[model samples]
Target chain A: MTKLNKKEKELVHLLKENARLSSEDLGQMVGLPSSKVQSLIQSWQKDGIILKHTTLFNEEKLESTHDTIRALIEVSIRPEKKTGFDAIARRICKHPNVIDHYLISGNYDFLIIVEGKSLQEISSFVSNTLASIENVRSTGTHFILKKYKENGIALGTEEMENRILVSA
Target chain B: MSPGFSHLIETIPSSGIRRFFDLVASSKDVISLGVGEPDFPTPWPAREEAISSIEQGLTSYTSNSGLIECRRAIAAYIEERFGATYGPEKEIIITNGVSEGVDITLRTLLNPGDEVIVPEPNYVCYAPLIQLAGGKVVAIDTSQTGFLPNKQAIKSAITAKTKAIILCSPNNPTGQVIPKKILKDIADLAENHDFWVIADEIYAELSYDEPFVSFAALEGTFPRTILMNGFSKAFAMTGWRLGYLCAPQEFIARALKIHQYSALCAPIMAQYAAIQALQGMKVVQDMRRSYEMRRNLFVGRLNEMGLDTAMPKGAFYCFPSIQKTGLSSEEFALKLLEKARVAVVPGSVFGLGGEGYVRCCYATHIDLLKEALTRISNFLKKR
Candidate 1:
């Protein structure tokens, strides 16, 4: 694959920052026509260079009363004959409650993020759903205490600033 | 009984800005697009330096010409950025702000009946300042020529009484930067007509389309060009109120006299801050890049909304024609404020050649800009 040009790379970074920017807005920044900008973005999406345009909503902010427990689980698993950790990693990730699952090195073979309604619900998943898997050897789960920062935004501060309204 | 105000003050025409802004100020939840300063806070290094200087008790008033180190730093900055040489000892005077620099330079150069040519739509302060200095203002309307000053119009305006011309590029209200070719023609006119050129380069660092060309740097023009600049826009240090006036020693000598009694030096802290602000151009470059992006986003959206805004080559404003809305500039601004709850300056407030448009400053967050544009689009749709 060919490397993206400087302007294209900058457009990509701008999209990553704010995917909702209109093609007209992107064209203005990248010095291209709206059609050109639209085509560039479309090509990137076709090539799988751009995964998706998504919003990261802080669940805590979205639902103040509703509680959702998020836990990170580290699991040890025996490698299968041919497919290695890929088959078991896929199986662990297929669980409905798993938010994120990654095959990692060091102490654990797989690092997974699980979301559940309660501590008992998460503990049950760790004991039953994860342990029952054929190659699963051992597992450890850690509940998140808080999220100080997420998606590069610091929480608990008003984004809008009060400034002098007008001058000449 | 109260004494009457000075006749000199009466010569300066009334400004509608104060009254108009009062209306905006009285309102709630109005998204203002009328600001003339950068939205960024002062860069950390400059603010840190000022804080340190204050902590060290550097609170005494600087000399009328300001601190020697600060002047030298400014001189170096002008030299590096614009390729203009200036003597730090007598050629530089730090003023309260570029506004003061404008006042002092006008006072130093003008005599009674002297006519100063000002191109419009331009900065809001120049015409009144010229009048207050006992000089007649000859306003040249440049809107017909892509908002760039016309050489023939300027030449015809020149006469025996012509004393100076004030040029601001990238200009306020319009965000139009006079191209190098246009500036050179004006330089030649200044040389031939024997007039001073008061260049308000306060917005010099904000020039986007091309590198900023200092009027003083053109051949043989340094002697005639009184260069004005400051950290207010570039460093995002508007409240610091630090600006520098660079001119010939003779001009500076007289300007120093007026500055000495009228304002003295700029604040000691801001001077110290300026000394650090000039130490690195990284912050300035970063801010300029952001402004460039904002300019694109704002101008692009304005045009898409059918406002017919020309691409601003520099500064942080986008002047869009409101003639299509079947509203005068003032009407558009006032109605937009009332209906859309968006505040902007009417182009007519900028003087002649500005009646059909409105100035929307883009030195704001992109989200706010988008929201303002959306609001304006809706307002246009309604009417």
Candidate 2:
């Protein structure tokens, strides 16, 4: 990957905060032409710097409606002679139920976040599917209890803007 | 005797902004772009410092010149940032805000009937304050000059009675920064005319496109300048009501006497808080960047909506011309509120040369700002 310039970094951070800003607005914010802004964003997308522009929803808010349990699974795997952890990490992370995956350091080789219908469903997946992988040694699964915040938005508490109606 | 007020007080009209405030307050679901101060709170560390000072019972008012440490910090900050210098002990006096600073400066300098030339479409308070101080306000109309102050016009307005010209670059309603060349020319005029320059540089820190040069820093202009600034807009502490005045020893001494008798000293906790405020330059820069982004977004969209808005080089406001909308600024402001539930200030509230325009403040959450712009766009389409 190429090193990002200052303007590119600003664009990235701005888009991270607000993915919905228009190219014209991004141009003004970063001091670039609108056409150039669109192309830079396209290049960043192609370069895999921007994985996706997606909304963050609070799963805790849907507890009364949706039947979903999120889990974080730690997998200890033996590295291949050449491919290291990348080969098995990719295989274990491609499951449809995996919400997020990362190759971690220390005792655990891989730490993945997965969502399923219930705690039983997540535990079964960790035992049956994840442990069955080639270089996987063992697995540990922990289900999430609650999330106080999601993607910078706090749950339950409302953001109130109380300004005097008009002031000099 | 009990019923009558002073002639000076009675002559001054009440604020034109009151009616609009009432209109905005009576409505619900309105996204208002009318406030003049920053949306952000005083930065956290400074607030914490104020809390600590209060809890420790360090709330006694310092010297009338304000806490010595705060004056020193302000002097150093002005020197480093705007290349201006003043002795903290003799030349700087903390005031209740720029509002009180202006009043004291006028009361100290102006003789009855002394003319003070104020460029119009300026802040609303300058004229009233000048009148109350028994000074004649010689108004200079800069609306014809892209809202930029013209040296020739100011020179024409000058008289032997002209005591000072109140300079508010990065001004309130129209965000015009007086250019360096023009400032040099104006300084020359003041030097030749032998009149004072009351510089209201409250918005100096918020200039975007050009670097702000304090008028007092210009050669020979120091003697002619009574510089007023505060921790209001720039520090996001408007409610704290803390500001200071810096000038020559004699000017500051006289202004200090007036401040001493009236407002006395700024709150002790706020003085301590301002010392801490000087340390948060990063927090200020972040707020400036956010304001710049919003200024860009709002100004660009206003132009697209057929309202011609000049991008304000500084300050949070954009004064866009609504003449093309086929309504007076007041009519446009009222109708927009009624039809779209979006509130903006009628430019007339800013005084002369503000008739055909509207002032929109961009110091709000971007989400609400975006929604307000959308409502305004729809309102214009319907028009």
Candidate 3:
């Protein structure tokens, strides 16, 4: 991987902290004109340095009725000679329930995070769809109990407390 | 009848910096570049330590010289970073803040009628603190030399009654670090004139381009130099009220007596947090990087707006000359706050050499800074 210049590194870190910040604000942060920042961001996007900008949700705030089941599925796959794990990974991600998937390095070839309406629904889908796929070896599924943090944001009631302003 | 206050207390003017801060607080929708503080909160580890210390009931007073472990951490940090050696047992005293450290050092070193040389356009508290210590302040005009005091000025300022000189590196308002050559020359002067050097290094860790040089680290100056530093600027622990003073054994012994009677010691919780801060060097580096980026942005924007500003080598403030706007520093600041809803400190508040400029702190959110700059641009165009 290529190393980012000082300005690029700062821009990336600031965006990671609060991606909702506007180009003007980012420009002010990294010492570029707004128009210049806009162009630089465009170039970064074209170069794939920035894959996406997303929001972090506080799931606890949702009504209990809206709560859903989520699980991490570690898949051991037998890679076909031509396609390796890429084909199987792509096919697995095609499921609407699969929120995120990553190629892995341990006993598992792929680690996938998926969400469903209920435990039974997720189990049925996993057994029927994931296990039935060709060249699939074995899978280990683990349900997520709670999320204390997500996407660099703390997900708890404590974060809502007011902070006292301090001056020097 | 009410007891009367001291004549010195009554005669000394209130801090001009505080006056501007109050004005900012009263106004609505004002974007301020007036505060000399870090925008970042204290690092998580330090805050966590403080919280845990309180949870564990570590709230009582510490030793008069502060917790020995905290002093050891500070000593290790200085030795590792600045190559300065001082015994933690006898050479250091934890202070409420560098503010208290400055006051204590001044009081310990100065006698009635003693004179101390102070550079103008500097941190506002130094001269007043000197006067409060019963010392006369001899002001040196460093504005003509790019805010760095020259050797000749120091020599000229020295007299039989001259006892010490106060120096702030990576200084406030002006943001100039005294160069190593200049520091060596000053050390030479100190030795020749037999005067002490009180170095306020509160912003030492925030230097962008060069490693900070400590006055005490220089040969022959350690004994005469009282080095003051703290967690406020570097670790973003301003509200914690933690700092320290390091000098020769004799000086620290004297200052410790004042500290015992007046302040006793820094808060026990803050001292615990400060220990964590010493271990959390990576966080300080991260904050420093952010401040460096903001400094570049703010100074570049000012220069593009036709304001002549020196690129600050350290700290989060930019001192820009408003002489081009054809207004006095106070006039410029008041008009900007009134018309643009952007608050900045008038440079004259700092001292004699600061009359034509204003101090704008860049330690604010980037969006607010952007808006403030736009408003300032608009206000200037209207003028």
Which one is best on DockQ?
2
| RMSD (CA, Å), each prediction | 4.6, 3.5, 3.7
Per-residue alpha-carbon lDDT of model 2 for B148-191, expressed as tens digits?
77999999999889999998988999988888888898899999
Q: On residues A1-168, what C-alpha lDDT tens digit does candidate 3 reach at each position?
A: 758788778778888877877786678667778898788789888988889998776777778735688999988899999999888888999999898999989778888999998999899878999989998899899999988878766676343112222123
lDDT of residue A86 for candidate 2: 84
Predicted candidate 2 versus true structure: per-residue lDDT over A1-168, tens digit per residue: 689888888788788888988898889766789999999889878988778999766656666636887988888988999999888878877889998899877888888999898878888898889988888898888888877777776687653266687877
Per-prediction interface RMSD in Å:
2.1, 1.8, 4.6
What is candidate 1's TM-score against the reference? 0.83
> Where does candidate 1 clash, by residue pair?
none
- Give candidate 3 regions above 4 Å deviation: A1-8, A14-44, A53-86, A103-111, A115-148, A155-168
Shift of residue A66 alpha carbon in model 3, Å: 7.7
Worst 10 residues of 2 chain B by lDDT: B1-10
**lDDT per residue, candidate 1, B80-133, as tens digits?**
999999999999999999999999999899999999999999998999998898
TM-score of chain B of each: 0.98, 0.98, 0.99
Checking candidate 2 for backbone clashes, the offending pairs are none
